[model samples]
Target chain A: MPLARRIIPCLDIKNGRVVKNVNFHHGTWDAGDPVELAAMYDRQGGDEVVFLDINASWEQRSATLDILTRAAEQVFIPLTIGGGVTAVEHVRSYLRAGADKVSINTGAVKDPDLINQSAEIFGSSTIVIAIDMKRRPTGGWEVYLQGGRTPTGIDGLKWAEEAWRRGAGELLVTSMDADGTRNGYDMELHQALANLVDIPVIASGGAGTLDHIAEVLTTGKADAALVASIFHSGQYTVDDAKQYLAAKGVPVRR
Target chain B: MAARIVIVDYDMGNLQSVRNAFKAVGYQAEISPDPASVLHADGIVLPGMGAFGNGMRKLAERDLIDPILEFATGGRPVLGICLGMQLLFEYGEEYGGGPGLGLLTGRATRLPDTVKLPQIGWNLVEPVAAAHPIFEGLDQPYYAYFDHSYAAADVAPADVAAVTDYGRVFPSVVARRNIIGIQFHPEKSSRVGLQMLTNFGRIVCHSRSTLR
Candidate 1:
């Protein structure tokens, strides 16, 4: 069989606590402690866990590292930490703290060289470039930065190609339009990115049901599906999602 | 006494996770750069990430290559993980190609172009040698997390303990007497991975008792 499609549970953290928000803003609520939630996901057979420091401030950066250290102790699966990663030192600090990979968004947009430099220093596999994309009013998606607050006029597809060329090992593409709706992933958006890049693309944003996830991994051509609200809201556990995927003929690790 | 398992730190990548994984499995593992410590340890774990050429260069610069070889050939158990596992082979065809540690008789080559590069995520591992200690208490065709683009290509069938398929069948687990190499990161492979570490610890203890 080919590689099993990954099911990743994302923990949106703020001030050392896991939080959930819709469309990157509004209705933010406490999910649980980051460490505990990560461990739970790991036990549930989550292919990977992501702790995104949604509110990545200078003071709270250490909190992220603290959570990572504690999670690394018990969670034996791959842990990816993202948010406010701007320099090689930030990547180094996360890796030293036991992060398997570091995801960079705004930093990579601000200095495209950050991807090249960090990848060169710490192998390309260690760097994950997260591109937050919003559907443009005139068609075609555009890249968003600063936690989805600022928008860059560059085309999302074009940026993805550049990021891959500059040494991004994987691309985490999140659709802002479909985010938090629980409707489904933007299939067209993900399909376009997946077809364009040779690297693995993780589909994020809208994942309401198991069928949505299976669709994204299959029709959307995504290598993995990143689910947050659905898992955090108790609508489905990682095991439930994996079983459903397996029953649907999607090859999962189980 | 517990076995002294020193994880060789050659500045390749994160050793803390490897040590943490060992700790989670009820074993104490220390990350050390001192060659003498590695040479004297009851068991040595070579863990790494990144390109094969860069990994070899780092090992050479830190003067760990010779000590590791001596320890492996000395009949003490030596386990290599991920890039560290690839380093056990004779050569690697990545980043301009370079010589490996030559402990195993295969060369590391890139996965076929038909499949995705860096074949990240979990895949099934089928034990070829059921008697190998690493497969103890583990089910056949178990799943392990793998994250690599290159794998052992021309390994002797006698040395391959397990195999995983991507674009084609490759040696996912290779064992030759006291030396074993796992292309997957057992440290990140959850309970099954932890069991493998425990099995390695048992092997270390068994070797120590027999030596006495």
Candidate 2:
């Protein structure tokens, strides 16, 4: 059999607190303490945790790493850190501070070679390429940077293929269209990228129920699904989603 | 005294988390590149991550290649993790080809991209040897977290303690005499992981008594 599908809980951290905003805009909503929330998720059998420093600033980075270090002490699963990671030193700092993998977005776009450089130095498995895309009026999605506010005008799918070619171990694709909608993942977006790249794709944004997760994993072909508010607000736990998916014959780590 | 577990820090594996796991299990753990620490430890954990060539280079640079072998041959317990596990073998096909520590007769090669690169996530571990003490109270088909693009390809079946299924069945855990290696990260595997480390500590304590 293949590796079991992953259920990752994402913590949008700002100033050491877990916070979230609708569609990556408007106002931030307080979630909880990142370290405490991560501990709870670890207890609930989360396959992994993605801690994105959503503020996208370098000044707050040391604070984020401090939280990551403390959180690493309490949790034993793989922890991935993203946001404001611009160079190999940033990657080293996060890994040294206890992150198993570092996800790059804006830095990678500004310098595509950053992917190759970081991958060469830290190994590909330690680097993740996160692409934030919003549905364009003209058709295909456009890649967004700076916390999904600035449009790079680069085709999301094309950029994803390039990132993979440059040695990114995995891709975390978030859909702005589906963000905060609770409708479901953009199956078309996910399927297209999943087929375009051989590396694993983690589908994020637009998740309200377990069926949505199952759909993304099975029909959507995402190797993993990243969920936020539903889990953060206690609407359902990671275990609830795993059990629901397992019942549906989707192989999930229990 | 608690088992003095020293993590062989050749600057590869996430030694901090590995140390934390052992500490959680009530064992004294330290990440040390010092040869004296490896020689005097009650047990040793050689932990590593990243490319096989780089890992080997680090070991050679630190002049740890022979001391590690000496520690293993001395019959005190030693555990290798992930790339460290791959390094225990004879050869590695990563980045063309390179020699490993040759502690075990096997080759480390990349997993097929037909499944996915860097097969990441938790997968169930099925024991090939049913009576090993490392898995004493763990359930069959127990889940463990794995993150790697390559795995041991040609190890002896006798050396395999457990196998995990990805695209093909690969040796997830291998052991010979006082040496043990696990492809999965026990430090990142939660409950099953803590128990496994505790079992390793027990093995170390038991062997120390036998030596006395």
Candidate 3:
């Protein structure tokens, strides 16, 4: 049989707490405990859970690790941690703290070699290069950093190709324009990136209805879809999204 | 006394999670690189993740190669998971083809690139044989988590316990006498995975008692 298209719930963590209204400059508001929400997602059959610590400090990173350590005990599925991860040691520490994988966003774009070195130490499968992008006014997507605050002017597709060549096992492409819009995923952006890389592409950012999730997997050719508000605000359960996708003949783990 | 299980650690990855899974099944498995501990164990759980070549180098670095071969040949139970399963075979093609422990007759090769690499997610595991100590209470077509880019190729049919597919049918579970290998993370695979571990635990205990 074919592999199931994964439904991953993303938890944007700040200072060790799950934050909902996070948009770079305005500051983040606490939503719930990171570990508790992760365990709940685990029980709800989230194929995987992503914990992105936005704008975290050295101390807050450790605190996030504590949450991951606690969550790993209860959450049986894979847990991926991101944010403030620039060095190889950060990847090591997070994996030790029970993250099955680590996503490198700004760090990778700046150093580039950081992706290769981390992949060498932790294995490519454990290293995910997350490309946060904003559609350029001219054309193409530009890489964004610092919680999507700063634009690096790096071409998203070129960077994704380089990251893959540097040994990134997966690519997490998030569209800043569509993020939190509830309009739907940036299918054209995700599809273009997904086509560029042979590795798994996790389509992230805008996720509204069950159709959005299904459309990204089928039309965008995303191997997995990541959603946040829909699952967090109790608008839809992970299972409901999964059942809807499965009924649409898109294979999903039930 | 409970069976003394050792989870061989070579810095491959996921060693702690593997130990936690065994612990959850009521076995206090030691995570050790010491050859003596491996030799003394009633059963060995070789847990690994990452590239095939790197894993072999780690085994050689820790001087675990010969001791593991001896333990497996000595008729004690041994279970290999994921990359650990691939390590049991004769060769692996991830990052270029190289020799493995050579306990099982096969080569681990990359899955067809048509499907996404690392093929992460749950898939059905169907037992090839009617009876095995590991399949205990599990029904056919049960889902187990899989996160792998490669699968064992040219394995002896008689030794394969279960098979799963991701663009192609590949061995999911293989067993021969006291040696067994599973290409999924039982710990991260939830309840059914724990149940499989429990069954392996029972096999360990039974083998220990019989030996005594």
lDDT of 3 by residue, A1-254 (tens): 76778899999887778886533445455668888998788778798899998745756677888888888777778899998888898888999999999999888988999998998777788889998899988889999888788888888899999999999989998888888888899989988987788788999888888999999999999989998988998899998998899899998877
lDDT of 1 by residue, B69-184 (tens): 89888899999999999999999999899999999999999999898778878999999897999789985788899889999999988999999999999999999988999999
lDDT of 3 at A20: 67
Give candidate 1's error at residue A197 in angstroms.
0.7
True contacts kept of each: 0.85, 0.77, 0.52
Tens-place lDDT per residue, model 2, A35-89, is 9999899999898899999775787688898998998888988999998988888
TM-scores for the candidates:
0.96, 0.96, 0.92
Largest DockQ belongs to which candidate?
Answer: 1
Model 3 regions more than 4 Å off:
A22-29, B93-99, B113-116
Candidate order by lDDT, decreasing, is 1, 2, 3
Q: CAPRI band of model 2?
A: medium
Model 2: fnat (fraction of native contacts) = 0.77
| Model 1 misplaced regions, further than 4 Å | none
Q: Which of 2 and 3 is ahead in TM-score?
A: 2
What are the lDDT figures for the candidates, one per model? 0.91, 0.90, 0.87
lDDT of 2 by residue, B158-207 (tens): 89999988878899999998889999999999888988999999999998
Candidate 2: regions farther than 4 A off: none
- TM value for model 2: 0.96
Considering only chain B, report the TM-score of model 3. Answer: 0.98
